[model samples]
Target: MSLESHRAACAALTLLVACGPAMADLQVAVGATSESTVALKVEVDRIVPLASLHPRLELRLATGLLLLSSEEEDGNAAWLLSPALRWTFSGERGAFLEAGIGGALFLETRVDSRELSTAFQFEDRLALGLPWASGELSLALTHYSNAGIKRPNDGLETLTLGYRYPL
Candidate 1:
């Protein structure tokens, strides 16, 4: 990872920690990507009530791990932690944009020559959710990247369909 990426990661984490006490929602989610990989993630999102401002706002801080597997190939894993800002249009039904910066550690044994690489990953996702009695179904488009640290860093773009249950 480059110095700049590291700095950015640290700064984001610091902000998340400072703002942790205000957030109070816990969510567990599961989703699948276009690459035939599944992701299970959990998040604690706190709504920052901004009644004083127009069009109320909320912020989220989340940390989770993603385990990726291919049926015809070996599996890979990544550790993810991100902080994001969200603006609500109508409480239950709204659009949100979030960005996450984390570390992606690829498994060495699965590679062709036992090569291992760790890179800084950043992802941006846009989501829409339909709230249910106990959970919500979310549709999202996500772009994942290694921030140019690795050669041929043609990042993975995925469309994720997910369900989240409040926990």
Candidate 2:
């Protein structure tokens, strides 16, 4: 009915699809990144079942929160939501390649000033895992920009390393 309602419905549908009958794996990761500022993040992703028609290897969903600190100002924070598709190659070890698009919301706060803005993000990720140990290591690259919303369009790029435990 409304924009917020639409977004909520979309999110729910995405989650439902991510957890369908073909789901096989679930993982949670914690990591940090180097970018405009340093940030720490926690993320979760699940493997989606592939169908003959769809032919995808996996589906993923993740959410992260990042904080950037400044010596001259208070700080800034961002919330990120992403959904991705991945292809896995199984070997003595397992490896995967992934790509996704998502949105981010940033809130900036200084001693007495505050601002809010939004951006769209494109991301690429790679990972290797050990099935016996239930451990995985991953690398990600992300790019962010305003999607022509007339808001602050300052762009940001980040590189991250992550370790995940399957649960």
Candidate 3:
């Protein structure tokens, strides 16, 4: 990645994290982006009222890095920025299911010689979470793709486990 891209990513992440509500939850997530890829993500989300969609809806901002680790693919990575809306069901205690969708921008479009066509993509996620007084534990399945906006819109999938702590 170019120095400019790194600076841009840092600036965007700062903007996302700095603008969140003072008492928002901070989460750190780790898991596989694919059979050959691993991802580590961090997000800050705040409860926002959107009763029509669900009682426990949140506005979330996230950023993560995907690590590619195969022969020549080693040392390859992408920085991701996503702004999403999440709706939780079954209330906020015990077991809960959350669904979310948003747009993402990747710092790199090609990894391991696989062309993702463009740097812009869409992300969809479904997650199961267990909330505690102090924090939450979650497992999420997420997909990222260009939605045919460009040719060869090869997509990526990630399965991640996360921990969220109030901040």
Cα lDDT over the full model 1 = 0.52
lDDT of 3 by residue, 64-151 (tens): 5444444554333555555556656666555666666776666678655466788887888888888766898989988888899999
What TM-score do all the candidates reach, one by one?
Answer: 0.63, 0.62, 0.75
In candidate 2, which residue ranges exceed 4 Å CA deviation?
1-36, 51-56, 91-93, 109-132
Task: Look at candidate 1 and tell me the lDDT of residue 33.
Answer: 53
34: Cα error in model 1, Å: 3.7
What is candidate 1's lDDT per residue for 56-142, written digit by digit as tens? 465555654444545544544444655556566575445454444444433221322222233456666666666666666666665
Highest-scoring model, TM-score: 3
Would you list the rank order by lDDT, best first? 3, 2, 1
| Candidate 3 residue runs with Cα over 4 Å from true position | 1-23, 51-71, 74-91
lDDT of each: 0.52, 0.52, 0.68
**Which pairs, if any, clash in model 3?**
none
